[model samples]
Target chain A: MNGCMERIYNGLIKENPTFVLMLGMCPTLAVTTSATNGVGMGLSTTVVLVLSNMLISMLRKVIPDSVRMPAFIVVVASFVTIVQFLLQGFVPSLYASLGIYIPLIVVNCIILGRAESYASKNPVLLSIFDGIGMGLGFTVGLTAIGLVREIIGSGKVFGFQLLPLADVAAGKSGYVPVTIFILAPGAFLVLAGLTALQNKVKNNAAKKGKKVREASGCGEGCASCGGCSGKVFPTGNEEE
Target chain B: MVLSENKFMMSSSPHIRSKTTSANIMQIVTAALLPAAAFGVYNFGLPALIMLISTTASAVLTELIYQKLMHKKVTINDFSAVVTGLLLGLNMPSSAPWWMGALGSVFGILVVKQLFGGLGQNIMNPALGARCFLLISFTGQMTTFIYDGVSGPTPLAVLKSGGTVDTMSMLIGKIPGTIGETSVFAIMLGAVILILTGVIDLRIPGTYLATFAVFVGIFGHFQNPDIGFFDPQYITAHLCGGGIMLGAWFMATDYVTSPITKRGQIVYGMLLGILTGLFRLFGGSAEGVSYAIIISNLLVPLIERVTLPKPFGKGGEK
Candidate 1:
């Protein structure tokens, strides 16, 4: 149970597919012009990833090593095709928006990587949880990027008016889109900024962990008098 | 500590030094570009020549000014400014306003190259980056290509407008385009000279042209049923048309932005070719050499990692 929990938590935060691991960048940059498209693509990819992982885990032992990669590709491709057709039929707008990226998801590497690394070795239940966690992490990342791009690129969110563009048109202030945000270059700038932010947060947490260790005096439970090595000095005098 | 000091001094890395400095290389590149410049002048006449000279001079002047302002050594004698200016001039349409061409050159040298730590430190080809900036900023003016006595559409523009250029006119330097890009034969001559002089490796240009030919052949047939499978002549026409030759031979093979290893060069060239073909086919532009080169430049670091050469005498380890 603890192992399963660890796997789930690790995928969600410690090893996020988008922010931390930086996987599936092609689709991340390509289809993230609008929030609606981002969510649509993210959910579709998540569905495919989860289903593929669950099926691969169940059939892991039956698969041979020599033919494993081809077999995994075939399974993933089948799921991708089904999703592609379904989206085309039901959500035609999203289908048009995503365009070639739907076909490209077959080679996304993130889905295939998890299927090979985790699913093939883990139990079906654990694989399923891992898929959910990773998929959600990818979703959060894509949505965050999409929100920033959309709000700035078009001054709209999910195709609805958040900030009043009409007010700007009527000589009012505070509604100007940095049109570059809708273009490809903006995707790189946003991704780099997000990655830098994640690094800063992680570094801060690591520093706090180090300070806590120093204050705890190596956890030795020793009682030495004056000039003892285990003494925890007051905060002001710690630097001395 | 004594042994470490001795070993450091005796280290075998960077074993060779040469009289061939970056300044010398830039000068040679500018010299090699002369054939294309002459051809451009012949095809486009006096205005094109004037624009080219002004662009180059302004680029050099801008670099000097920036260096002076930043309190850095004014290294305009290196001739990189001239190379960038000529490349920028070659990228603009023959009849472009002198001011626009000069502005493009300034952007190339000052903003794209110098602002990013100058010369080798720039991530993308500065000339192409500035060209893309001009294209986006002034689409109407930038795309206005002109031919001899006929101020009209370019071959790519004609194609986009549902027409085809006379193949013979395109082959000769009579078709509409930038000064240097007007003649495929002249560009090839310059490329051959550069290769013979060892200014550039044959790998990048060779792979880039081959890959572009393959894609054009495949896609051209798919689009037009009349054009048979494996249309070699269409591939040639695609190569000769627009900036394909200029980019494949000169711009895409830029040493600073391109990968160093042979394998990485091949991958980078092929990727540039595929992306160029795709953008030409699907995107708004009929010619995508600038965007394609920039995209490939961004991937060079990754390609280097994947194709890194193994150290001698090192066995595989876990």
Candidate 2:
């Protein structure tokens, strides 16, 4: 049970396909222009990923090695087609917005990568967990990027105004939203800024881990070291 | 005196250094650019000179400011800023306001180059990126080209408007267009100098120009059946009318933004030519060279990875 839990945790955080591994960057950069579109696309992709993982695991042994990649692609494409049609029939707004990207998800490396790496080798239950964890990680990443872009780009969240504006009726000032954020170049700028932020976060985490290790006095490869040991030198010790 | 003589030592990664400094290379390139620049000034006059000065100054100023802000050692003395400024000026029309040129230089140096970690780290040509930004932002100002003291449509605009110029007029800069794009003869002369001086590789510009010529020849022939076969004039007019020469020789071959490998350079140049042709034929632009080069610049890294030079004894692995 603990081993299964570890696997699930690993997919969600340590081996996150989007932020940590930098997989599926094309869709992440393309469809993340708006929060609504981002969430819609993320959920749709998650559904496809989970279902495809489940199906692939069920047929893993029956499929041969020579034909495995083609078989996996066929399975993923079928699910993608079904999702594409369902979205078109029901959520036509999202369907229209996502347009070519829905078809593009068939080639998204994350889905195929999960199918080949985890689903084919693991049991059905473990594969399902892997799918759910990875899908949710991707969802979190896309939503975070979408939220930043949509808020700054449009000054609105999910198409609702959060900041009040004075309309300057007699002798007052008014609020006006900057419209540069909605353009294509703004997407590139925001993505670059966010990627830099992710790098900073990862670097900070590494520094903190090093500090924790030093406090425990495990200078070399000591096995029995505990959490706390000596006086903490916080600043210059970052070099060590 | 002979017994007391001392030796000077300099240690660096490159133990064997050449006399070819970055400044020397930049100066040589600028020298090679003189023919085209002089032709541009002759055709466009005082406005071209003003725009050139403003663009170059602004680029240098932006680099200095960015270096100060980023707390890095200042490198404005290297003449890269001058190159960027001159390239930006050449890309724009002479009629562009001084402020527009300044804004372009700011966008080029501060936003594109310094913010991306400066110089060699920049993913796209800073000048070309700024040009695209200005083109998208100030379409009215950017597209208006002047000729013979008459503010009129560019030759590409004439083509788009279903009009044509005599091939002889275009070859001599008589047609309305941006300064550097007025004479194909002058541009070819400058390109030859740069190639001979080893300032740029022949692969990119050579492939790009040849592919572009073929595209225009095949498509232009089909578009205008009234024009006779082997119409050298129409071909010359097409080559000189727009941003083709400037973009093909200077902008597309920007060292930092273009592919490194020879094969990658060929693919990159060919794709850029095809896209430029498509944009000119079907899209809402008379010339698509700037946008085509920028798009290809974005794909250079991917092309480089796919066309990586093979490692010895590592052939069989997928």
Number of the top lDDT candidate = 1
lDDT tens digits, residue span B1-318, model 2: 554445744445777888888778777767766787788888788888888888889999999988987689999888888888888888889887777888889889988888888888887889888888788756777887756656787777777566777776777766667657777777778788888888898899888877877787777766666655546666666777788888888788888899999899999989988888778756788889888998999999999999999888888857
Query: Model 2 segments beyond 4 Å from truth?
Result: A1-13, A47-90, A100-133, A147-193, A208-240, B1-18, B28-58, B61-73, B94-125, B132-152, B160-162, B166-176, B179-219, B248-284, B291-318
A3-92: candidate 1 lDDT, tens digit per residue: 344455666677778888899999999888888888888888888988999999899999998899999999999999999999999999
Model 2 pairs whose backbones collide:
none
Off by over 4 Å in 1: A1-240, B1-15, B159-162, B315-318
Report how closely model 1 matches the true complex, as a DockQ value.
0.05
- TM-score (0 to 1) for chain B of model 2: 0.89
- Reference interface contacts recovered per candidate: 0.00, 0.00
When summed lDDT is taken over every stretch of 10 residues in candidate 2 chain B, the lowest stretch is: B3-12
Ten consecutive residues with minimal summed lDDT in candidate 1 chain B? B1-10
